[model samples]
Target: MLHEIVISGFGGQGALFAGQLLAYGALEEGWHVTWIPSYGPEMRGGTANCTVIISDEEIGSPLTRHPTAAIVMNLPSYERFEPLIAPGGVLVVNASLIAQKSQRADIRIIYAPANDIAAELGAAQMANVVLVGAMLAATGALQFETLDQVLDKHISARHRDKLELNKRALRRGGALAV
Candidate 1:
């Protein structure tokens, strides 16, 4: 199976990091994976995104014109990527930050209040992780256990203290998907 996913949001919102976590989990599962990150020049608060491709076979390209799934953390990202999802694909929207509702009928839309959930978890920065959890439940691209492993093995030492919080955010988001 091949799953191409895009994660988009403002810089510093952990969009790229969320994609990296997916890549790491895919890699651990012995799948072929590629991650490409992009961001505007304005840096933090600017637009940032990353594309992650996970497949059982060798991948030929890193770019995808229409992804199989996407996680949009803001209205701008939601507007930009909503139309780019392939038919029958999944779209995870951050409902806490976006005011507009999705109009697409061909794709599955999951509205997750990531920001509010993260705030309740006491770390708004983990909103991205919350979305990742939602993506995990919605797509089943990677196992939840694999994500837990990725968090434990791949997170940097400096951020180790927030590991549990991240896990909680992930669980909260996954709950939304169910």
Candidate 2:
């Protein structure tokens, strides 16, 4: 199985972090994985994106011209990546930030109000976590337990207090996926 995905949004939205988590999770499952992050000059509010590929076989290259799926957190991300999703692929949309509806009919679309859900969870900065959860639910790309383990690896002593919140946020996003 091969899964090529792009996650995009503003820098502070945690797009890169989400991709990192997915990469870690896939690696834990013994899958070959690659994660490449990109961001503009301005850090926080600037455009941020990451490409992640998970495969069971040897990976020839990391670049994904047409990804299997896209996790988008804003309208700009949607506009940029929507056309790049493979036919019959999946698109996870953050309805809280994006106003335009997807025009593509060849792929599966899942909408979650990531920002709103994260805000409700009292971890507004975890909007990307919410989308990650939704992607987990929609794609079943990685097991929940795998993600839980990956989450533990990503958390540091300074942010241990947020472990539960991130876990909850991921579950909340999974619920929102459907």
**Candidate achieving the largest TM-score:** 1
Writing each residue's lDDT as its tens digit, candidate 1 over 1-178 gives 9999999999889899999999999999999999999845838889999999999999989879899999999889999999999999999999999978888999999999999999999988899999999998999999988999999987789889999899888989999989
How much is 51 displaced in model 1, in angstroms? 0.3
Q: Which number leads on lDDT?
A: 1
- Using all chains and alpha carbons, the TM-scores for the candidates as numbered come to 0.97, 0.95
Cα lDDT computed for each candidate against the true fold: 0.93, 0.88
Give the 10-residue window scoring lowest on summed lDDT in candidate 2.
Answer: 37-46
For candidate 2, the TM-score is 0.95
For residues 101-170, what per-residue lDDT tens digits would candidate 2 score against the true structure? 8889998888889888889988788888888898888887888788889888887687688888889989
Candidate 1 wrongly placed segments (more than 4 Å) = 39-42
